[model samples]
Target: MPQRILIIEDNKDLAHLLELHLRDLSYDVTLSFEGPKGLAEAESVDYDLIILDLMLPGMDGLEVCRRLRKRPAYTPILMLTSKSSEVDRVQEKPTNGAP
Candidate 1:
């Protein structure tokens, strides 16, 4: 069985390109354009790996990671970031629920 991969990226072009490459290598890939939907997809399957994006529409990658950790997704997460200030941006977000 091919190893399953979930890519949570808002960039459709990048996500699809990555998916194509991974598929060429005989791996199964699933893509989600938003954090909330990605989290839902991640929880629904026991993917071998999760490729998360730092910036997303509904929620941020760190928040998704936090929620998964709360339930303990049991899947490895490989977070991707393009910005140098990703750390600062992630830290600024509110946790423990929306205000």
Candidate 2:
């Protein structure tokens, strides 16, 4: 089975770009524009990886990441954000097998 990837990006163009790139790489991709829906999907499905945008509506990506971590959901997460602080925050997390 293809590796499953979840993408939470509000920007339509960027989301489309990511989907296209991952599809070319032969990975199954799912997208959610809002934070609540994204969080719901995250809980419902088993994803190999997740690409989350920081400036999501309803819930911030940092909070989402923190929540997932609290649940001990160790699926690899790649945060896609415009904020410079996002990089700093990610560095604090233990990234194991993350691309």
Candidate 3:
């Protein structure tokens, strides 16, 4: 079976593009336009990977990632950022050296 990917991007256009691209690669894709809904979906289902964008409505990606980690969710997260600050923030590993 194809691996499933969840994309949580507030930008409608980017989310659509990602869905199309991943679909072409034969991966099952799910899209969410807001952070709350995205988090709910992520927690409720199993996905091989997640492409999450920072600066989302309702909640930021960092908080989302932290929450996921707290719940022991080990899904690989690829955080998308338009700001250099956001990129730098995500690149910083936790003090415990977790992914």
Weakest lDDT window of 10 consecutive positions for candidate 2: 89-98
In model 1, how large is the Cα lDDT of residue 24?
A: 100
Question: How high a TM-score does candidate 3 get?
Answer: 0.87
- Encode model 1's per-residue lDDT on 1-63: one tens digit a residue: 999999999999999999999999999999999999999999999999999998999999988
Segments of candidate 3 deviating more than 4 angstroms: 85-92
Give per-model TM-scores.
0.85, 0.83, 0.87
lDDT of 2 at 45: 94
Q: For all the candidates, what are their Cα RMSDs to the real structure?
A: 4.8, 3.7, 2.4
Total colliding residue pairs, candidate 2:
0
- lDDT tens digits by residue: candidate 3, 2-84: 99999999999999998999999999999998888899999999899999997799998877777787776588899898887
Superposed model 2: Cα runs more than 4 Å off: 85-99
User: What lDDT does each candidate get?
Assistant: 0.90, 0.86, 0.87
Better of 1 and 3 by TM-score: 3
Q: Give the top-scoring candidate (lDDT).
A: 1
